[model samples]
Target: MHSSNLRLEEPIRMASILEPSKPNFFPAMTKIVGTLGPKSRTVEIISGCLNAGMSVARFDFSWGDTEFHQETLDNLKKAIKSMKKLCAVMLDTVGPELQVVNKSEHPISLQADTMVVLTPDQDKEASSNLLPINFHGLSKAVKKGDTIFIGQYLFTGNETTSVWLEVDEVKGEDVVCMIKNSATLSGQLYTFHVSQIHIDLPTLTDKDKEVIRTWGVRNSIDILSLSYTRHAEDIRHARDYLSKLDGLDQTQIFAKIENIEGLKHFDEILQEADGVILSRGTLGIDLPSEKVFLFQKAAIYKCNVAGKPVVVTRVVDSMADNLRPTRAEATDVANAVLDGCDAILLGAETLRGFYPVESISTVGRICSEAEKVFNQDLYFKKTSKHVGEEISHLESIASSAVRAAIVVKASVIICFTSSGRAARLIAKYRPTMPILSVVIPQLKTNQLRWTFTGAFEVQYLLCFSSCSWLPLPS
Candidate 1:
């Protein structure tokens, strides 16, 4: 059903009221990314997520068809417009991912000294296997004495790496090798050359791009998230392709960083893309789990330094199906906020969950709370010199004043910021109250769309442009 068919209990802009004496309130701008799925497709559920502070709704093309996807997109637009919030939607495409073609249901269990035979014919599921190695490229990557790890079970042998072995006996279709640290049903496979295998598909799958284009024309989506991005070219290609569509150039493209290839070309990728997404779920499969956390942190730091928004996502909790998040899960949510990310994403938590509302509420609570302490230290500790000599003296004054207002709990901080530099400063401080920003030039409003404080109350003040508009040291 469309959002029009569903009723919202309250307006989407309604902010939660903490105790009157409480010192903290919501930050100036915090964007939440909620994935769309069975649980969240209903108008009521989608509204609940939005009410819980989701600024953007994402349609994961990996799961649904065109009809379902488009319908959901329409519903979100109706909901946001009805609520009078400038809503943003994102379309995420599933890229070329390696997979185990075919396998048996039985677990390929092995003990120490167990002799397993691998053959060419046994490797074939629906088609023919050209090589004898059970895995697609195990022989090429492994050596005669090299250690072989099969789902935490190790095997070493004197047999030549390339030598073909006949399946002397079979316990199941093939031995499940490299079972992850967690016993996930999504099996892992060893392969050579980890890169995007062109699936002869549109950068945005045919179905997905159509929906994105439609949403763009209607101003439904503000961001286009490219999943499985490998190089700078991917971002360029997406931007160019989308540029051909009407009213879509305003929609920014974000490259989802998941694989090693994307990380190796980080700088170039960041330049070509508007933002980045730390998609840890697929990343965990491609890399060791231990490394994912640090890699995510580095990505966040890079994005923040570059003034780009970054979204950290994955199974931050089991609440996708349960109401309450585990204690550890709560801490994980807090950590993402403390890391200074622009947004934290909820996948199954909001999409296919039993307690969608509760999950969003918990995430909102943790992020809003953590942002208070982290942002305060981050912004207050910086010196005026660190703000750069480039900022005119007056802009700096406006920025400092806004920060002071937040520190003192002013009902509203009215800022006369032209370049938006002043507002960004106020936003970085994680002010507890709303900021009523008065911009000198009307065009400057567009530039602040993604900035920390641009999201606050935007009002245009009458004035002509001037280089000396900001106070100078002289």
Candidate 2:
């Protein structure tokens, strides 16, 4: 997988990133991840978000094209330079989900209780308003009495509306579903399974692979969120693809748990991926609303035990209006932080929402407040544990540093190192003290952005005695 072209790019000279002191001031144990979209892609907006406490920038490829993503990457780099923040970038793949193919720009409205035919063809023109699907074996995979969700994707905006359908009949290539309710329609390749039928689909599409090879090979991303991950093998497959890319050694794989199959193989997938995302919107289609949040809690607990990055996503729904979050929404954010989720991801809220910055600030305020009352005994859980069992020097030092800080009641633990291994190990202990880690080679600093949950900051310090250098703006 190694590309010569990828290997040729000169490693960024360390001298350019050094600064006297740029404080990393996020004091909460949890981090905020804001997704980029049409609304939040500008350099000004992205820089504002990073300065306002957004630690990770997520780009979901499920909606945008390659050109759109490249623009986002460009803006994010500009923002990174503008804010002098080493924010991590997560490029999420579309994965294997079914969608609808609407050739017409106008949404052909369908009525309630109407009978419609579902075809798998994408290019075939529709007749009599028959909807076309992207999956070829759609009829074969479904049976009568099976539930089919006929969803509406608003083209004018990111808002989605959909109705349920019960499979009434199937004949050869056509599967007929009766609409349980009315819905507007406009989207691509839409489908969600209500049953336990997991199709044999490629983990990554051609487009997904292309992005990884191009952007990943070019060192444009920090992490890749593999979509629709059903098995641990899915994570392995994605990593297999990334292994060949040059300079992408730092790019980690994050598995997204959005379907029933993914949940079933949760532990295995969790261990395989760098982190996991509890995607509520997609999970809701498979499970009841109550069950979705319940699973989210359990998922968070499992990830904590494994010492991995676990994020609870799609929590704020009303932010689309740019209005203050409802009481329940506000409570949801606080609860997720209290539940030990390492991060809370804002989806449409930061993208299309009228108040993107306000939403980030709101979540930051809630998380900071929650961390103020966060009980270490309850959250970290003191159990009879093993220590110093074949631990590396860096790991051992991190543990000792954390203990020293706590014993002296030190407010901040400062560690100067070449790599971020010491900082990561300190984070694993869930220390009470803020970690101000000074690292070399800016890439390591960026990777460490997701390593610690507490008030952790990575300041790049490159001493180029052999070459001239300029410190970052004070």
Candidate 3:
């Protein structure tokens, strides 16, 4: 019988639904990350996202300023208080990236087959004939006859607004290029792609370190998503920089696999980073668009075997404008869930989408349905076999707990966690039943540690010095 046609809901039970007191339980195992922007930064929208199943709130540091992010963070705290839900805040840094610097207030228009000068001078203002980029080594990096694609390459996959330029001549600190296509160039951070050319750029920019020291430290973000992670050294650098901060030592660093270099050294990067985010849109630009899906599947599978949380973004790009996603987008979300990704990150769908709430709800529903059809037993067997004979005591207990739950047809597996390690271990086995992780509030920072645990639901347990448990305040 087809797995989708088979109803697996009858055999397994949900303890939260059966009990009267646990009204706050969320059953969806797959977490949803909602990017906060102008459209969804308000308290009402954020609260709606939370109720609709947004587990993480992401702030894109590339666009907004420190003041704007602070306002958004303030609004997020208000929404969390109003909704009484725990949502993790993720700070996405603008890594070593190049962007067109347009000094004019309005967008500059370029004509097709027109000659233009590309310079690395930051002070130089961009015009119809001249364009400035953020990278200092722009001329040194690209040789004559190289192609540079600008606009609509990062985050958004809209190719209609993209401008293509072919390098004609390489002069001192300037590369003259002819615009292959006429497009309006907006002053936004765009992905600069030179086909098959690896631009030697630092993983972390000075701005990235400053953001970590200021905004990241101020807000106490739960996750620091390193953009364009090339290798393990990138993760280590970001981790080391974050450690130097006062309270950011525990901040989780998620390596974003966007370019070919990142994919080349993904295993080592994954070992160093706390989690991984597959940026399909950016990867599509770096590689052939056709191979993005293959890379996504491979990266997700590798992360699953490693027992690290993996997040897939750009699943529903069309949902930014439309209320309902395309049939292909729906299937894509379901496939990612079936692929065993721990979370699905909504980029434009939530950041500037017209229907943010509906998008979250739509993804949540798809995740819950897809999870029902997921082959947990087969997955567990494969994952366990990957561990082989060498296993830690925690892994043994976690594997046993999952096996015992399946044997007894348990409603839910309840585990008390201090550091959330044991809970994360059990979640790695991918049990059919939800794992409720109850964390004891020993340190205040421990509360945010459960953000990426992959647990179905997390609750805080109130305890006294006498070791007596009390019900969490409603």
Query: If the candidates were sorted by their TM-score against the true structure, best first, what order would they fall in?
Result: 3, 2, 1
The residue-by-residue lDDT of candidate 1 on 162-255, one tens digit each, is: 1112222332333222211222122223221222222233445565666566644564355778976778998998888778886565567889
lDDT of 1 at 91: 73
Error of 2 at 104 (Å): 0.8
Superposed by TM-score, candidate 2 places the C-alpha of residue 333 at a distance from the truth, in angstroms, of: 1.1
Backbone clash numbers for all candidates listed = 3, 8, 0
Q: Taking the tens digit of each residue's C-alpha lDDT, what string does model 2 give over 1-474? A: 342211112574556436332333543556778898888999988887887667788887767777887888789889988777767777888777676767764565667788888877667765334877777777777788987765432111232366667899997888888877666665444444545567668777888998888865664467788888899999888887777776565567888887889999999999898788888777776787678778987888787666677888877768867568888888888788666777888887888778788888778777766555455533333310433267567666766776677678887777654454555556655556556665543332455453321111231111000011122221
Between candidates 2 and 3, the one scoring higher on TM-score is 3
Give the candidates in order of lDDT, highest first.
3, 2, 1
Q: Provide the overall lDDT of each model, using Cα atoms, as 2-decimal numbers.
A: 0.55, 0.68, 0.78
Clashing pairs in 3: none
How many backbone overlaps does candidate 3 show? 0
> On residues 408-450, what C-alpha lDDT tens digit does candidate 3 reach at each position?
9987788776666777788888887777666644423365563
